[model samples]
Target: MATKKRKKISQAFTKSQLVKEISERCDLNKNQVTHVLDEMKDIIASHLKKNGPEKFTLPGILKIQVRNVDAKPSREGINPFTKEPTVYPAKAASRKVRVTPLKQLKEMA
Candidate 1:
C-alpha cells in the first residue's frame, strides 16, 4: 500500500494571500489582521451566547456572526482503531458559518 503525503498550511497564510492582501490594502500589518481576527472571534462568541446569533457584516471582506443553534443528544460510536465504544450523553450545541462571496474575490481566484 502507498501512503499519501500531507501538505502543511501556515497558521496564517503567506503575506501574498487573500487575508494578507486585505490587510495590506487596508494599510494594516499582518499582525494587525491577526489581532482583529482574535478579538472578533471572542466578540462573536459572546454575542452568540448573550444576545443569540447576530449577523455582523464587514461590508466587502467578509461577514462574521453567529446563528441560533439547538443542542441535541447524540449516540456514541466505537473507535475503529481501538475497538472501544464510548457514549457521550451530554448535549452539544451546533455552530454554523455562512460566507458571502464577493465579486472582486471571485474574479481574483
Candidate 2:
C-alpha cells in the first residue's frame, strides 16, 4: 500500500481557495459550494444564538458551545513584571463561543 504525499500549507486557505477546493472535490459548482457555506454559517449562528440551543455540532469535525461568563469587579492586583499594585477594571459578563475539534479533525492534524 502507498500513501499520498500532501504539500505543507504555510498559511490558512482563503475563502476563495476553500470554496474552489470543496467544489472540485465534491463535484459541485463554485456557486453551489458558496451557497452551502453561507447556509452553514446561518445554521451555526441560529443554533448558537441567545434563545437557541447554545450548541452546534458538525459531526466528525467539531463542536461549538456557548458559555456564559460572570462579570468581574474591579480589584487591585500585583503586577508580576513591575512588582507594583495595579487596579484591574471590571469586566462585563458575556457569552463566548467555544469550539472544540473532534477526533477526526484532531487526527487530521
Candidate 3:
C-alpha cells in the first residue's frame, strides 16, 4: 500500500501580509490595519515595561508574560581544547517575554 504525503502548513506571517489580510477581512484600508497593529505593539511594549515580570492576558487569544531570569554563579571549568582550568563569570539577571495561548484559541486549533 502507498502512503500519502501530508501538506506542510505555514506557521508565520509578515507585517505586510497580515495587514493585507486583515484589511480585506475588515473592509478597511491597509494603512488603517497597519496603524492598528502598530498601536497594539506599542501598547503591549508599554505594559510589559511598566508591569515588569508579570502575565498580561489578551482576552481569548493568548497571555504574555515578562520573566526575570537570575544569573548563574561563577564556576571553574576545564577548557577542552587547551586542557586548562578556567573560571566562568556569573551572568547578570535579565528579563524576557513569554507567551501562552488561551484555551479558547487552543481549542480552535
Candidate 4:
C-alpha cells in the first residue's frame, strides 16, 4: 500500500500572507504576527465563553461582539449521521462575531 502526502496550510491563513499584511501596516515580524494572532484567538474565545463577547475596535479592524441565544435542536426529527428518526433537544449557546461589517457589507453587494 502507498500513502499520499498532503500539503500543509499555515494556521490562521498562511504565514506569508499574515506577515506581509502585518509588516506592511506595522513594525512586526512574521513570527510576531503569528504569535499575536494566536494569542488573540485565545483571548477572544476566553472572553466569549467566560466574560461574554465585548465590543472592541482595533485600528483598521472591525468591532467584535458575542451574543447569547437560545438554540433549539432539530425539530425535523432525524439522525444526521445515520439518517435515522430522532428528536433533537433544544439548547442555549453564545455566538461571537464581528459586527462592524454589517452595514458596509450589506451595502457592497
The 10-residue segment with the lowest total lDDT in model 2: 1-10
Model 1 clashing residue pairs (backbone): none
Please report how far candidate 2 places residue 60 from its true position, in Å.
0.6
Per-model TM values vs. the true structure: 0.39, 0.81, 0.72, 0.45
Between prediction 2 and prediction 4, the one with superior TM-score is 2
Ranking of all candidate structures by their TM-score, best first: 2, 3, 4, 1
Model 2: CA > 4 A from native: 1-11, 81-83
The regions of model 1 sitting more than 4 angstroms off are 1-53, 94-101
Per-residue CA lDDT of model 2 for 22-56, tens digit only, reads: 77777789999999999999999999999999999
In candidate 3, which residue ranges exceed 4 Å CA deviation?
A: 1-11, 50-54, 77-86
Candidate 1's TM-score: 0.39
RMSD per model, one decimal: 11.6, 3.8, 8.0, 11.6
Candidate 4 lDDT, 1-109, residue by residue in tens? 3334534646665667767776556766778887888898777667656465465544354566665565766576778799999877677665646456555555654
Pick the TM-score winner.
2
lDDT, model 1: 0.67
Residue 33, candidate 3: alpha-carbon lDDT: 90
Better of 1 and 3 by TM-score: 3
